[model samples]
Target: MKSFLYPNIHPPSFTWINAEKTQIEKVHEWIKPITNKSNPVECKTAEIIVLGVPLSRSSISVSGASEFPEAFRRSWRSFTTYNLEDDIDLSSMEILDAGDVPMHVTDIRKCHQNIIQASTALYNHFPASTICAIGGDHSITAMMVKGMHRAYPVKKIGILQFDTHFDLRDLSDNGPSNGTPMRNLIESGDVNGTDMYNIGLHGFFNSQDLKNYADEKGVHYFTLRQMRKAGVRETVHQCLEELSSKVDVIYLTVDMDVLDIAYAPGVPASTPGGMTTEELLEGVLEAGKHPSVMSMDIVCLDPLKDAHAQPTVKLGTHVFLTFLTGVMLRKV
Candidate 1:
């Protein structure tokens, strides 16, 4: 195994109390007690740090997704869940909102470096705790992967990308963008392309060349059609089995575009036949069952595009809760 690199970067300095200035303060209050200095006698403290990397115009129009972290925080205050039947308790989990990473709005490269720096800082303090990153765009996923590799230094890391698009676009005339996160990670050699698995791929947008490239790289491509044929339970089981054997750690990345446009209209990209929100929840729940999952990210939320902010924040909150539930369940 390669030795882990501990970067001296640090999370932006801000108090959680300042969240009260935004609509997400209510959500902060809800999870604050559990994440407060007083709770969690046995459970590992979350430190629930929130790092917002709102990088817009990254070779794609989904640039509006940069507002997701703040939007999610503001919207989570009103969000509620009664999925106790599924073994989830929002009250028991410790979640801290660490705030967003500071970045130069006009500079994509600088923004990317800022994301890596902030994420590396948080990883230093909470190497074993969950770090929930809100999206500026999908490009941030590459840096998150970088930070995880620097911290864990595993020989093999499995990347589970749930999205409507393959995000396999190579570096272009404008450089890397949200659509090229996976490709960037692979190109940078931070993650083995062969160990990657992309789920929820749908639509007619993909070409034969893209499919062949993914296959040639040994990236496991699981289409929605195949998953439907195998059934969610069996498909998820098989994915876990394969990933667990091939990698020491797993990173779960969710792009909201994977959900149907009707279910998630707030994303930069939308596909009509995408997975339903319930299906997404179930898939995440199942993925979380795998003990090897090391970190997770929920990206591509555009509050501006969402009507009344109904599903954008709601969906984001649910994903966050589902991720927490998955992490907790894995501990058992």
Candidate 2:
């Protein structure tokens, strides 16, 4: 793993604050950084393995999303491993932060290939762990899911995509951008469209042709209005129930643009009328507790575009923690 891994550490912005935590109760105690080379880590023994992939060169829009992982670490120090609302403590959980994936500067294709290799290696080596990835763009998710498929060919994998756009853009004229991941996955036979489900799809970001493609491919989706009308909890429960029965495992990929722009304007494609922070959290929580969920990712957010305090990054981090909160309940 060290051959492909880059060391991760607490950002200087909050190191002083984190120092206080390292002393006693560890106020900002979160994941254990796998920073040692001599002391090799066995990833499969951990309950959760978190990895960062900072490859945003493939986004269709101009982006600084590659900085998201470090920003997340900074925000991570502001919070704790305890969920006050649920009275759950994650400090004892064997979670390994294996650090960020080494990415190519100008080679998008190379980056994707490396991501696939990293994902396959992680999933293959850590088959017993829940692999949670932090992405540089939605494109990385395609590679992540594909990697999982490569690692475990016999397992029927399902996708739970929470986003506004269909992410099925035609790539005849374009390269492998974030918009084309799902299409590539579907066309390459890496995943079956019948096993995929999209939630929080709203706004007019997608086209009729894309809708036709989705319908023809048998992809399941729920519009923002549809989920709201049916109730977030009920709709998500329905999706999980249907997909879990059909597939051996589910992989959740959350595009931050699914969030309302007011809550997450950092994402290039985010818009109004998308899911609220609370709504998205509820859906993620549901996925976290499901026995079939093997992996998950949060993507499409650029920290550079966020507010002065970077609320969107912070909120995204919260979404990550909320997912883990639900995961803790599964133990009970």
Candidate 3:
């Protein structure tokens, strides 16, 4: 019986996203729990606490994505707390930053367990709060989903994934990587296959076996071509309508590689043609509006591989903020 490790890493303070020093407060200025501190600032009032898991060892192909959490936090200033689309300001929103889970534990199994245990604690402590786990890779998705289920075992959990690949492959010789999270989740019965809704799956990035598995297990999915024909809004509407009827909760996960390579060249599994940033953002916003969506994550923004301007990180931050905007609207 190996207990997970917890390291002492001080969480970074939120830098105000608002640069103009407007009367409206910025998201960066929001207070968060200091890492490893027993007495974190009063976060019970927070509706959401964002946690980072910078473990990339499970990624089958690319690895440097462990850098996304810090990079995303650094890019927070580029966004505004004001939600232009929903016409809402989040200055009044109580947000807590719980800092990153230490990645020093070299054993991938221990790392995975650490994520589950930490996430479970966060969710249990803040039962009313949505835990947004920033990923080191898609593998973290499995851990977070499990943690959420552990916290609320009575409810049926659903998954809404926006990505180019199905990520349904079984474990390889190296064990569970980013490619296996969905498979692991379904197999573990944490989420019923039919309750999992995936959008924007496309290209040669996936294989027939994985696609077959998705269909065989009754996973609801819309291909990128289908989404394009039906429109992003319509596709998302369909996803929400179907999943909402079947499950008590929805967990939204977005892999940045879902965006076209032009938009998100920094991702570990980026492809040439995929959803536009606006489409992905729209999907996220729509997903957030659902009452059933309890937690969310955005993964695969590798700063180490980013372009000079850090376009992926910038867009990723926008999506993150915009999702919060949707959550604010939900409160209204």
Candidate 4:
């Protein structure tokens, strides 16, 4: 893996949102195993570790998502208990709240570099561990993939992006931003563009230019309409089978906007008539179960827009927990 320059970035302060004193008390009871005494716990040996990269930059989300990491942590306090069906105890696992990566909101380049630095450190430290990254925005996907590429240079990396938009805009003039993550990843040369696959793309919002670009790059894509026509199970099965043949390591990136606006109104960009929360959960869980999945990122959640905060926090927890269950089952 390539060495990063900013290894000395300060750790993030845990600022919980909407958490009452009693709620925090209950959360701390179970989270003790994950958090450190002086600092948050750093898992030395664990099959999986959840790292919070709450990087909120104005360039990424128009409403700002830097506050998501703290809000998510607070919401997790209520839902962190073990599940009997999965027969897995999260507290028993080598899970750690590595905290958020520091970012210079004024300098977009510096922020991207910081993400690369932090993700690269984690990848190198735990080569075998599955990384569950809590995102700042969809743009962070580019840096995370770059870090993974550095860690496993020989592995053929594939990106499975669950989003409504194509995110293939080549913004050469503006540089890389949240809307241009996929384009930047393809241009980076670390990942094979042909091996990339995007799911949940709906019509009307997507243009022919984006489709042409995807076709030109040999990127595999599936629309929500097509998935509805073929049924979710068959669609997901075909996607996995096709991607498995093209790449050795698969990284899944889920943009909350992929869900219908009614289901995920807290995202920066909400599209109507998209996948439902239940369908997304099922599809993502199935994808996570695949042996090729190495790491995953969930992004574009805005708590401010979420009335009662359930849409952003609860949905985020649901996705994370489902993925965790899938990973545990894969081991068995």
lDDT of each: 0.71, 0.82, 0.80, 0.74
Per-residue alpha-carbon lDDT of model 3 for 1-332, expressed as tens digits? 11111342225423334345446444565534444443443556678888888888888876688888888888766666777667888777777677777665578888888888887877777788877888789999999989888988998988999989888997754367888888889888898999998998887888898889999999888988999899888888788888889888889999998999988989888898899988998888888777888899988778888999898888888888878877877867
Tens-digit lDDT track of model 2 for 100-123: 777777888888888888888778
Best by lDDT: 2
Tell me the tens digit of each residue's lDDT in model 4 across 1-332: 11121342344446333433443223334442233343322355666756666665734448556667667777766675565666765554445455567778589788888888878877887788888788778788888888888777788888888899888887774478777888898888877678888889985877798789989988888889888888766777677778789888888898888999999878888779889987888888788778888799888888877877466668977787777777766867
Clashing pairs in 1: 23-74, 24-73, 24-74, 48-96, 50-98, 52-100
Write model 1 residue lDDT over 12-121, tens digit each, in one string. 22233433433332444655422223333333467354555666667387457766766776665565533565755554556655556667758878878877877776
| Local distance difference test, candidate 1 | 0.71
User: What is the full ranking by lDDT, best candidate first?
Assistant: 2, 3, 4, 1
TM-score for all predictions?
0.85, 0.92, 0.91, 0.87
Model 3 ranges off by over 4 Å: 1-24, 35-41, 172-174
What would the TM-score be for candidate 1 when compared with the true structure?
A: 0.85
Identify the superior model by lDDT, candidate 1 or candidate 4. Answer: 4
Stretch of 10 with least lDDT, candidate 4: 1-10
Q: What stretches of model 2 exceed 4 Å from their correct place?
A: 1-28, 38-42
